[model samples]
Target: MERFVNWSGSLAFDAERLRQPTSEQEVIDIVHEALDRGGSVRPVGSGHSSTPLAETGDTLISFGRMAGLVGADKSNGRATLLPGTGLAEAGSALAEHGLAMENLGDVDYQSLAGAMGTGTHGTGRELGNLSSTLVGGTLVTGTGAVVRFGEQADSAQGQTLLRAAQLALGALGVLTSLTLRVQPAFDLHRQNWMTHIDWVLGHFEELSQTCRHVDFYWYPRSDRAQVRVLTLPGDEPAISPPGYLKKDERGPSYEVIPNFRDLKFDEMEYMLPLEHGLEAFRRVRERVKDRHRDKVGWRVLVRTVAPDDAMLSNIRQPTMTIALLQNASLDHEPYFRDMEALFLDWGGRPHWGKKHYRTAPDLRRMYPDWDAFLTLREKCDPEGVFLNDYLTEIFGLQGAP
Candidate 1:
C-alpha cells in the first residue's frame, strides 16, 4: 500500500500505508488505530495539489479505491459523493441527472475533496470557487469522532463548521464524503485568440464584465496567447459545440501551456488587489516593457474566481491575478528579487503554494489574519499530525511529534 508522491510534478514524498477505506467505519477504525500507536494520518485525494498539503511522515490515506456516485437529490439539486471521485467523472454523472457544478477548475482530474481542500477554481464574475458549492459533508474529527454538518442546519456550531469546512485543509480530520450544490446542466460556447497587452488592458473591465466565463493566457516568449471566452445561450436548451470547434485541442489539459520553460524562467505570481483588473495589467505591462526592453519574455494571463478563505485564494477580494514567468536559471536570486520588488509595489500577494522566496514575517504582512489562521490550525490539529517539512519551513510551526 506504499507509493511515491506525484503532486504537480514538482516534489515527491515516499508514502507508507496508502489505505483506501471504502466505508466510514473503516476510516474511523484507521484513525483510532493511528491514535493508539501515536502515529499520524494524511488523507490524499488524486495527488493534484501544487503544495504538499497531503504529505505526512506517518500513514497515507488515499481515497482512490473508495469512489463513485454515492447519492443525489434531484429536487434539491444536491449530490453526495465519496472523496476519491474525480471532478469530471462526478460532473458527467451529475449531468445525466440534469445537474452540474456551478464552477470547475481548468483541470478535471482532481478529486472533489482535494479541490475543495485547496480551493481550486475557474473564472466567472458572478460564480465562486468550487468549495463555495459545498453545502455539507461528514468530517471525522482529530479524535476519531464522526460528525455531519451542512448549510441549512439551524445550530450555531453547524453554521460555523460549514463555513470552516469549506477550506478545512484536511487538518481537522479525514473527510469521508461531500454534499455539493448543483446547477442545471448548460452548454458553453468558447472563443480563443491573441491580443496586445495595451488592448487587453484597455478593455479588461469590459471583457470581464461581458463574458459568462472568460480566461486568457499570454505566452512568455511570444506576443500571442491561446485565449478562450465561453458563453451560454439564453432561453434555450444547451447546444453542443459544432463538430469542428469541438475538435479544437485542449492544450496541456492539466497545466498551463509550458511554452518557455526552457528559458529557465524564475516564476512569480501576484494576487493583484484591485477591482478594475485591467488597470493592474496595464501597469505591469508598462513597467515590464519599459524596464526589460526585450531582455525578457513577458506573458500575461487573466482568469476569474469566486472568493473563499482557503488561505491561498487569489480572488479573496474582487481581484485579478497577473503572473510573470521570467527567465531565472541564469541568476535566479536576482530575478526573484526584481520580481518581488515589483509585486510588492503592485500590492500583490504570492500564491501560498508556489515558488516565492518569502519568509514568515513577509507572509504575515501579506495576509491580514495570519496569526488567527495559525490559532485555528492549533485548535483543530494540536497534535500536528498533518505537519510536514514544507509546513515547518513556511509557517515555522514546531512542537509536533
Candidate 2:
C-alpha cells in the first residue's frame, strides 16, 4: 500500500491502489474499472486542500501526468487546460499566449481543477472565486461516462449540471479538462505594510472597495496586522500612512498576484456575509486574545470574495472570509472549533476544501440549492464510485458502500 499525504501533512491515507492516468481515455477506463469492482475512486491534485476531499481507501488517481495547456483562444481570451495543470503552470502557459487569469489565490501550487473545484479565490471586491471563471469542461461522471458542461452544454439541464459541477468537491466526477475565462496579459502594482488591527477594521470597507485586491493578516500577540493591496499599475494609489511601507513593486498579474508560501499550516476558513464580517472578526479577535492567545503562534487572515452561482459556493453574496491558520505541528482543533462557533453564529459557510465540522444538516440551511446539487450528485454518481467515508458522512449519503 502506498501512503498519500496532503500538502500540509494534515491528512494521509494508505490507498489500495494509486494510479496516474496520462490521458482522458485512461481516466475513463479507470473509472469503469472502479465501477466494475464496486470500489471507489478519488482524484488527488496538488493536495492543497486541508480537508479529506481526496481521501479514498480504494483507489487514488493523481493527475500529474495529465497536465498542460490544451488550447488557447487569444481572440476570445479563453484557455483550455488539463485537470492536473498547476496554477503556476497555467499562469505561465497563458502568459505565453498573452493571456492571464482574471484573478488568482495567494498560493499557486494547486492544480487548476482542484482550485476551481474548491472555489479557491483571490481578494477583490468584485472578483469571484476561481470557480466563477470556469466556463466549460469535461468530467468523467460516476457512471463512467464523459459529460460536457458549461459553455458546451446546450440545454437548461446541462447548465444546471455545470452549476453543480463548479464546486462539487470531487464528489460529482473526475474532471479531465477545464476551460477558463482569461484576459489579455496585464500588470499590477502591489503594496504591503504593517498597521494596527484597529485601523484595518476601521477602514477595511474603504480599502476593499477601492483596491483591486486587499487582504490582511492579524497577529494576536501584537494586536497588529499586515495589510496587502494590489491594483493596476495606474490605478489610484493605496492609502498608507507614512513609514508603513514594507514592500512596493510592480509585475505581471501572474507574478504579482500569488505569494510563495513556504510554511506548512492547517487552515480553517469560513465565508461570512459582508454585513456581519467585521463584527464577527471583532468577536473572534477578542476571544482569541482572551482564550487561545497563549497557544496560538500564527496569524488570522482576512479577505473578501464576490458571489457566484455555484450551488455550493461559500460566497452566496458579497462575502468576507476569515481564515484561522495554525502551525501544522500544533494542535488546531480547539482554536478552530472555538472560532467556527463565532462564524456559524454569523451565518458563515465553511470553505469546502478547508477544515470544518459542518455536516449535511448544517450545510442544507446555508445553501439554497443544496438539494438540487445533491440530486445532481446522485444522478451523476449513483454508485458512489467517487465518494469516500468523509464525503459520505458530510453529504449524509445513506447506505453508501
Candidate 3:
C-alpha cells in the first residue's frame, strides 16, 4: 500500500484500499462495487494537487498502471493518450512525431487527467490551461459508463463538454483517455535576472510587449527578487542572464516546516491585462515591503503559451500572473486576511490549485460567471460523489447523497 501526497508540500490522505486498475472494465467494476456496498470511490493521479480533492475512506484508484501513448493522428496534428501518461512523457513522445503541446506547466510529473482536473496551466496572455488543448476525451462516470464528448457542431454541447473537461476535479468521474490538439515544435529563448521591485512595476507593460512569455514570483522577507522573460525566435532580443542561471528553479526555497498550513505568509496575485503586468507586480512588492516588518524574500518568473479556451484558466485573456511567496514561522490566517484585502483592492483572482482562504461569497465577487460553473458541476456530478471539505468550503457545493 504505497501512499503519496501533493507537490505543494501540503496535504495527504491514506486510503483503506489503494487499487491500480489496469483496464477500463476493471475501473468500472471497482466503482460499481463501491456503490453496491454503499461506499464512495475516488481516483488519484500524481497527487500533485495542493487540495485534498482525492481523499476518500472507501477506495482509492491510481491510474499509473494504465498509462501510455495509445494513438496519434499525425495528419490532423492530434494525439490520443491514456489518462495516466505523464506530461513530460507526452511532450517527449509528441516530439518524436514532430509535434508538441501548445504549452506546459513548470513541472512535468503530473498525469494527463490530474493536471487537467485542477486546471494546471502555463503562461501566455492568449493561451488557456493545458486542458484547453483537449479536443476530445473519454470520462468513465460514477455509474461505470464511459462517455466521450468534444468538438460537436452543436455550440451548446461543445461549450458544455469543454467546461466539464477543463476542471473535472475528479467530481465528474474517472478520465480514461484524452485526445489533444498539437502544434509544430518550437523553442524558447529564456532570460533571467535579479532586479529592483520598483523597476518591475513601472516597466511591466513594455516588458510584456517585448516578451513572448512573461511571469514573476516574489520571495517574501527579501528586498531582492529574481525575474525571468522568455521570447520566441526572431523577437527583439536584449541581454539575457548567463545561460546556466536561466535554467534555475524559480519557486520557493526549501525549508523544514512541519506543518505547511501554519506557516505565516502573505500573497497578492492578479490576472492583469498582459500589458500591465510589470507595474502590477511592482505595486504588489511595494505594498508588501511597507506592510510587513519581517524579512521577506522576492522573485519573479515569466513564461509563454500558444492559445486555447479553458474556462478555469488564468490566461483566458492575455494575462500576466504575479505570485507573491512569503516565508515566516507564524500563523497563516492573519497574513492571508490582510493579503486578500489588498488583492480585492487591486482586483486579483486566486489561483485554483494554490493555497488561498477565499470563501464562496468572496469568490462570487471575484468571478463573473460563478453560478454558471456551479450549474455545470451539478449537471455532470448530480450526486456530488467527489465533493470534499475543500470543494464544499470553497465552491459552496452541497454534497450529493
After superposition, which runs of candidate 3 have C-alpha atoms over 4 Å from their true positions? 1-4, 152-159, 219-222, 234-236, 240-279, 293-316, 326-333
Model 1 stretches astray by more than 4 angstroms: 1-3, 152-154, 234-269, 286-300, 309-314, 324-341, 358-376, 393-396
* Model 2 pairs whose backbones collide: none
Clashes per model (N, Cα, C within 3 A): 2, 0, 22
State residue 271's C-alpha deviation in candidate 2, in Å: 0.3
Question: lDDT of all predictions, in order shown?
Answer: 0.65, 0.90, 0.64
Cα lDDT of model 3 overall? 0.64
> Per-candidate TM vs. native?
0.81, 0.98, 0.82
Highest TM-score scorer: 2
Cα lDDT tens digits, model 3, 86-184, are 887787777777777776775677898888887777765555668788887777776667767685224667566666666767777788888888877
Query: Residue 331's C-alpha lDDT in candidate 2?
Result: 97
Candidate 2: where are CA atoms >4 Å away? none
Q: What is residue 297's positional error in candidate 2, in angstroms? A: 1.1
> In model 3, how large is the Cα lDDT of residue 266?
36
Model 2 misses residue 249 by how many Å? Answer: 1.6
* Candidate 2 per-residue lDDT over residues 24-100, each given as its tens digit: 89999999999888999998889999999888878999999999999999998799999999999999999999999
Question: Which candidate model has the greater lDDT, 1 or 3?
Answer: 1
